[model samples]
Target: MRFIIQRDHLVQSVQDVMKAVTSRTTIPILTGIKMVVSDEGVTLTGSDSDVSIESFIPKEEDDKEIVDIKQTGAIVLQAKFFSEMVKKLPSDTVEIEVQNHLQTVIRSGNSEFNLIGLDADEYPHLPQVEEENIFKIPTDLLKAMIRQTSFAVSTSETRPILTGVNWKIENNELNCIATDSHRLALRKAKVEIDSAAHYNVVIPGKSLNELSKILADNNELIDIVITENQILFKAKHLLFFSRLLEGNYPDTSRLIPTESKTDVVLQTKEFLQAIDRASLLAREGRNNVVKLSTLEDKIVEISSNTPEVGKVVEEIKALSVEGEELKISFSAKYMMDALKALEGTEIKVSFTGAMRPFIIQPINDDSILQLILPVRTY
Candidate 1:
């Protein structure tokens, strides 16, 4: 394989694909990146058995040459070394040539290195997904959905299904939900779908997080295709594939409370900041717990106390406080996560009781909902 590519484009492609490559894989070839040079462009692929990412650099784009293909061939190089080498190369262009017996030579301005390459045939093939059920979503909205819910995925390995965010599509609406038993995040958005096909799939939170980073924050539409076991996201010049989690995600619809005994409307920023200050003291104790209690005249008190550490108390005036007065204790970390995810100025918080799960959501928007189970404080 032989090719000459622009240095900046090569570095960006390498970094993007490297996100899928891991050194801890059982297959040694999985640690390497496969490069294929064709008449149209140069393609780079990275995989770790669970996820795969491919980037394409066209030979010429907009009458400007990005890659000058010398020969049509394929080669696999050590991703860790090759990626690092390309980043530090002091040249506007880079040349790669594969010699006999898989000896690869990389050259740039005044610098040259030889790396032993593996046969690209040994690399595992990526899953082939059909475009029958393809759907489109705006890139910025997709990123927001991931950020709003991925944090609630369970980190424990005991229940693998809970480690992924559940995706359900029905009636032109897509709903994403994630929960770690203690807290839950839900985000819903309207989409355009031709077929009446409803899909209920759970995608690994780690995969969504990586995909969010790979996708640019723009108004471009992203094409998504789902197969039986794999999901493919097609962006401009990039293709990402992630394996779906195997087990059935637990039904979380019943977990949300249907009634509220106490409700308060306040500014999201202020509530988040108050909890942030109280968490300092809570962090010194066993559990990062903070307490909230409603007072007369629409005043809400946020406080945290630790025997070894000091106590913090802050009061904020709510827009309106209704229902029965309530006092609840919950993890400060959980509250802060929800508040940050909401990303709204005005928020409404509802408490069913002192011990039941409470809900937080934007005052006028019904699309996003956050629920946190109160912690037991003795």
Candidate 2:
């Protein structure tokens, strides 16, 4: 294989595929990136069993040449060394050539390096996902959905299913939900899709987090294809694929409470800051618990105490308070996370009782909801 490519373009493509390569992969060839040069362009692929990424750099885009292929061939090179070499190359263009016995040479400017390459045939083939069941969503909205729910996925591996986020699509609406048994985050958005087809896929939160990071915050639409066991995300010249978890995700619809005893509307920033200050003391305690109480004239009191550390109390007036006055205790960290995921200036928190799970959501938007299981302070 031989190719002379622009330095910056090669570096970006290497970085994108590098995210899927793992040093400790059981398959030896998985540690290397497969480079294929064809008449159209250059393609780089990297994979660990669970995830695979492929990036394409076409020879000419918009009548400009990005890569000039001297020969059509394929080879695999060590991801670690190759990525570093390409990034540090001091030149506008890089020339790569392969000789007998899989020996590869990379040259740019005054620097040249020789690297041992592996046969691309030994690398595992990427999973093929059919495009029959596909949908389109705006890139920015997709990233927002991932950010809002991925953090709530259970970190514990005991319940394997809880480590993934549940994604359901029906009637042109897409919903994503994640929970760790203590707190839950849910986000919904309207998308254009075939209303006759429905989808329920459980994608690992870790994978979704990586996908979100790679996606740019643009209005361009992204194509999503789902197969029986794999999901593919297509954006521009990049293709991202992830394996779906095997088990069925627990039904969480019943977990949200239907009634409330107390409801309060408060400024999101004020409440978030109060919790941030109160958490300093509670963080030293066993459970990092903070107490919230509703006082007369729509005042909300935030307080926390620790045996070894000092206690803290702050009062913030609410926009409106209805129903019975209430006091509840919950994890400060959970509250902070929920508050940060919310997008509105004002929030409404509904409590069924002191010990029941409470709901927090934007005042006028019903599409997104967050639930937190209160902690017991007594």
- Looking at model 2, report the run of 10 residues with the lowest lDDT sum: 210-219
Q: Which residue ranges in model 2 land beyond 4 Å of their true spot?
A: none
Residue range with the least summed lDDT across 10 consecutive positions in model 1: 190-199
| Residue pairs with backbone atoms closer than 3 Å in model 1 (clashes) | none
Count of clashes, each model: 0, 0
Quote the lDDT for 117 in model 1. Answer: 97
| Number of clashing residue pairs, candidate 2 | 0
Alpha-carbon lDDT, every model: 0.93, 0.92
TM-score: model 2 vs. ground truth: 0.98
For residues 160-272, write the lDDT of model 2, one tens digit per residue.
88899999999989999999999999999988888988889899998898888778889899999988899999999999999999888889999999889899999999999
**In terms of lDDT, which candidate is strongest?**
1
